[model samples]
Target: MHQVIASPQGDKFIIARPGTRKGMQIPRAMHHELSSAVANGRDVPGWLVNAGREAWGLELSGQPARGNVLVRPVTPLNYSRATWEINKGCNFNCEHCYLAERAFEGLPRDEKDRLLSMLRDAGVLWLQFTGGEPTIDRDFPHSYRQAFILGMLVEILTNGSRLHRPEIIELLSAMPPHKVTVSLYGASPESFDSLTRKPGAFKLLTKGLKAAKEANVPLELALIVTKHNAHEVQAMREIADEYATTYTEYANISPTYDGNPQPLAAQAPGFLDKSSVFKGCPAGHTFFHVDPHGFATMCKVGRENPIGLMTEGLDGLLRLPAIADAQMLRSGGCSGCQLSATCRVCRPLAKAYQEAKAPLNTYCQHDNGDETA
Candidate 1:
């Protein structure tokens, strides 16, 4: 319930409000002083009070830092960011969804509490709750509130179908998220409903979007361009502009996370943007992903050697970095490939394409007869 969070993000000390994008980097001395004041149940230092007021317009003049500002403790774990799939149960059936199956199931409430605590103990400062659609999850409100209570900045990735619900709007208004990223299927009701294979889907999404906008909830729109809705891209951008919300267009569709090629059929021709050259990433080393059941993976695209958080707890994560390294090895069909240096796909993603037996031209430069490394 603290108004702001003060935490160590890697080597940097930052003070950030939960709902706002603005954050201030403070000196280590200032962080320590604030921590001391909060621990001792003393008033917030005058400088922080002034800084909060100036940076976020917060009125924390004489408030106890203990209740006004949460000082997140540095943990043994080095992770600073994570994404959790609250549940894979989405209300819409998008053809290009990456999950092979949309199972509407997750850990019970008690286990979810344990998992969130473990995430907090693991040093996760920024947590994104995604799903097949996170808004519809029965425990979403509780889990979202719990994450806030645990002093983690929370974001949500949704389809914007349920944002209009009174309880949801109320929960979000009361405890604002760092962001709510909604995926826009199409601009028109006919196109959107047809693409999602759900009648009236567009009406629900627009309703949710308007409600969220009116609530002043932070929002970002992802315009998902596929074969069914590729023609509506301009209109979708107009919608985003209408709301004055930040937007990004995603046209490159990939196979399901489990290597099913069904989603590839939805890829819009001439709209599949070429990915940039594969560079190294800090998946398990810095940030990781979690499934609804608390199984931690290196990232969403690479699901190998998942560590069961429900069983092994935080110690299970110790194995992730090594596992991530092994998964990144250029083995299998990619072994001895000279073009890997300039290849657009990473090892795990390449492995997925290989598993799906997809056409080489979709992911490999070698398929185009380019031998340069």
Candidate 2:
């Protein structure tokens, strides 16, 4: 079975399995015990077993657990990759956006520079610049340039509407990101604009993509499958094929960051049918998201508990108790559910449903109305 174990000191976690050569990094505080147990490949310590149960919902039989525990483990002292949302303000109001019309003031130029410097100091090797729209941020080029100069591989996630601007193309052509992901909403302008509620957005996105292609920036196309544009998914795929860019698709539409299910209506019918069993999330582990306000959370799906970057710094914030606490799964009837084999629902969304008894139809693979679970 595929599984992972939490760090003994409670900062990082690792995927532990038999026949694998990786395990948790020896915590300085519990070096002897952890090191011995990990080396023997005999048994996991009681605290680690209990932490696995509590933090990750791991069902450990009363036996000596042995195997490669840490698969691509993260060093508690630093993270090599990060997803930074430079600005929360977005021009489009896509119906299925996880962020509910995100709007926020951006960090000043000096503050952005400081954050960029801190990221480089923390040993970030790849920085993904994202936003409501990253290119829309006036301070983006400065930060992107700085990250590139620091020798970090930079990437951008945008809707491709702003790439058509001459200045935008010039900046990108000068120092292209490692990759540019343009989310395609619809195959046609009418369908795309109807879904985005922004007239001429599809045209702008196409023009921007053409410009980016001419500039020779590595590009990718992602399709957001929704009820409004589900029919256009294949057409969008064909468009991406024509562009010779990497193509991907996501049918699931999650609740907003605020736990509001307003965008749930746009979810395509039978989207959950394709989901497989719940494995685990990488939150508080190898990956984390930093919002516009410098608050770090596991991911953008749920922003329930956040650590302030200014106060804690990336290392300190990630090590904070809240980061691990957020990973803890509420029982909420999922522990012994019969559908665990094909259940794709995650703990964060389940927690939201548990607290409010809200119905999240998007994750209901079996179509039952029991919201308490």
Candidate 3:
């Protein structure tokens, strides 16, 4: 089990325990004292208890409190789960991929090992291994095994092209990723291969799904809605249901992380007019995205401003003023706009702000027909 302590001043600490990851935030002055007590297994001082009670209604005791020494049901820094794009290169070039073609360039093996060590030490509880395609990386096995051995819940996001191979399934069954999610492009070979631009990829994907089911790998399926496959979304869901796997759908198509607009034109109908705004986005505050070159950003699409993971380390990167002050980026015109209620794009997903001072045309649609500046 892993325990995390987040200070009100934006510092995070990971403490080991039996089970459950606990998080708390206190003032900077009290952080050192509380962390010292946690590390030494000593009772929290009187001052610390008073501060905890006033600030966050924290309950603490020398004896076990509901199986944990310190009890904090929540914290501001919810930095437990993270998505690491180990490699950017994918075997197939899907038409609607958010990543550009250059995304296939991956970091050197040694750099990958170093980053894994940093994440483990930082108390990352769940690691989602994503990429242009993670299986395409040769060093993926080594990195996956390292995280698994560290007691971290490992997840893999793949297209399921290589999963049919006996050796691939064997490795998955042996170590066993916590979750294996495969992206479904289309229901049939024609629709699937047309989108992936890879001949016979649909057959390979289905074969991999079958192999995964036979090998007892925990499986899930997701449908990515594109103009090419919008009509077949229901058929794809039925296929997933037949496999007895969890299914989900996402209709929104994003511009490339590197600011390419090529895929923007391929978005399905109602993709843009479907404006919805999630009140709070946890990207920089609680979650972060790491690119192939060890660059850590608030989110995958917000790569314009990045913190170098290799040079600064996780702790240092998280403490930066830029990351700590994470909040939704809204325009003056958007404040009074009626469409704000249904705007689905978050700050990081708004490439307009990250690139040039422009409003996201896709997210500016208003049912009331009010013009936004």
lDDT of each: 0.88, 0.68, 0.67
Query: Which portions of model 2 miss their true places by more than 4 Å?
Result: 1-76, 318-322, 333-336, 352-361, 366-373
Residue-level lDDT for 19 in candidate 2: 19
* TM-score list, all predictions: 0.96, 0.74, 0.74
Query: Any runs in candidate 1 off by more than 4 Å, and if so which?
Result: 365-373
lDDT digits (tens) for residues 177-237 of candidate 2: 6678899888998889987889998998889888887877778888888887888878989
Residue 292 displacement (Å), model 1: 1.3
Better of 1 and 3 by lDDT: 1
Candidate closest to the true structure, highest TM-score: 1
Q: So what's the TM-score on candidate 2?
A: 0.74
User: Quick one: best lDDT, which candidate?
Assistant: 1
Q: List the residue pairs that clash in candidate 2.
A: 15-69, 16-69
For model 1, residues 161-224, the per-residue Cα lDDT tens digits are 9999999999999999999998899999888998799999999999999999999999999999
lDDT for predicted candidate 1 compared with the true structure: 0.88
The sequence of per-residue lDDT tens digits that candidate 3 reaches over residues 191-309 is 89988989999999999988888888878888887888888988999888866358778776766766566676667776544544467665665667788888877667766567788
State each candidate's clash count: 0, 2, 9
